[model samples]
Target: MHKALRLTALAGLFMAAIAQAATPIDVYRDPNCGCCKSWIKYLEANGFSVNDHVEPNMSALKQRLGVAPRLASCHTAVIGGQFVEGHVPVAQIRDLEKHPELAGIAVPGMPAGSPGMQTGQVHQAYQVIGLTRDGADRVLASYPADSSL
Candidate 1:
């Protein structure tokens, strides 16, 4: 009975490792960008296995990924065949699976309190903009300022 229990625990651990390995996302950022590193750490903590790529010309990469200048941020991530720009929250990132109409999502500028951009308890109002397949932009989610100051 004890042997069977040990085998079950081992199988569970093995499956857990495979699950972790399966949630891979590719992140592109400048090597000197500290916030980008923080964001990578945040993603890993949230169960994403990040493949960090340091790019010399971020503008070119963004352009290739169809990220418009107005929707630009410090870093870009590719997951679920969609581009994720800036410090978007994990919830929205995960929600990308449900929205096949969207080409990608962006947080625009790095707003304080967003995932990797957290500043203590302080957070700023921000919107997660989704770029549609037809090239129109829409608000997928909005985060209001933290009022519990």
Candidate 2:
């Protein structure tokens, strides 16, 4: 009976850990930016619990959060202690959550076919950039064509 109880407790603990693994995103953007609003909506649609914060100076907010220029975008977000820039796909965010060692993920400038920025059938190859606090950056993932979704 004791062994059975222990096994149940372990199972409960594992379930709790899975629940806690969902990514929590805090998005900072300019109040007047329509694209930023769309980005938040995109995140919500993709399973991230987004906490939106509108700021007068998004540039300052980005700087405060240590976002690099190469990763700059219309808005910024922090998730699990990592910065997320621009219209980053939710899949990449999930990938980041799985790999906790990554400093951050970014989509750089808004591409025409990116999540919230999707317009027409035009598609472009883009990179999800990973960056350190000191501004060191690298390509975390590359998406090609309009079918990247």
Candidate 3:
């Protein structure tokens, strides 16, 4: 009976982990922005489930989400209660999930070669900026000028 009970508990934990993995990331972006769509595809290709929302007033949404104007980008995404701004890479997004201390992360502007913003081999250097709960901004990751990823 104890063995059966343990098996059941383990099955339940596995199911919970699967559910967490399937959690869809909610993304808000302007309908007219092609780069936003590209970013969505990029997320999907990277195995993330996305719930896309075409927000009419993105400025208000960004302000409400504690994303400062300085971190502005073409689109915004929310996952695990943290905002992801711009074309941040998948690796950084995964890192953000591990750090609850960060309110959100951003790649200021639409830099070429970052995820969906990729322009062939034209990879420009960029940094992933993190916003703390107390409203402090910090550099989380940096991609060098010649970086292909």
Candidate 4:
């Protein structure tokens, strides 16, 4: 009976490792960017494993990843073959994961109370925009979704 319990525990651990290994997201940012590090911490807090890629030419990298200048952010991410631009929330990122049909999502500019750029009581209502590889964009999720803040 004890051996069976031990095996079950081992199995659970193995499965957990597999789960962690599966959802690796690549993050590209400037090496000098502090906000980018904060965003990475945010993703990690939401159970994502980030592969950091520091690129000196962030503008060129964003262009290469198909993130439109209008929807650009300080950092960019690639997850499950989709581009995620800017300081997008973890919930929105999770939603994007389920919708592979969409090319990507973006938080546009750095809002005052965004995950990475947080300050006390500073709430700038921002919109998370959905995008296609061909440059079309639409509002995907609005921050403070209810606008009660």
Top-lDDT structure, candidate number:
1
Best by TM-score: 1
lDDT of residue 11 for candidate 1: 100
Candidates 2 and 4: which is better by TM-score? 4
Against the reference, the lDDT scores of all candidates come to 0.93, 0.82, 0.90, 0.86
Query: Which lDDT tens digits does candidate 3 get at residues 85-125?
Result: 99998889888878899989999999888888875778889
Candidate 2 lDDT trough over 10 residues, lowest sum? 15-24
lDDT of 4: 0.86
Model 3 reaches what TM-score against the true structure? 0.82
**Which parts of model 4 have CA positions greater than 4 angstroms off?**
1-22, 145-149
Question: Which residue pairs of candidate 2 clash?
Answer: none
Enumerate residue pairs that collide in model 3.
none
Where does candidate 3 have its weakest 10-residue lDDT segment? 15-24
Per-residue C-alpha lDDT of model 1 across residues 35-136, encoded as one tens digit per residue: 999999999988899999999999999999899899999999999889999998899999998999998999999898888898578889999999998889
Tell me how far candidate 4 lies from the true structure as C-alpha RMSD in angstroms: 3.1
Query: What order do candidates take by TM-score, descending?
Result: 1, 4, 3, 2
Q: Which digits, one per residue and each the tens of the lDDT, describe model 2 over residues 22-135?
A: 457899888888888888888877666788898889888888877777679898889888888898888788778766656688898988788888767778888898875565
**How do all models score by TM-score?**
0.88, 0.76, 0.82, 0.82
Q: What is the overall TM-score of model 1 with all chains considered together?
A: 0.88
Q: For residues 5-36, write the lDDT of model 4, one tens digit per residue.
A: 99999999999986766568999999998999
TM-score of 2: 0.76
**Residue-level error in angstroms, candidate 4, position 53:** 1.2
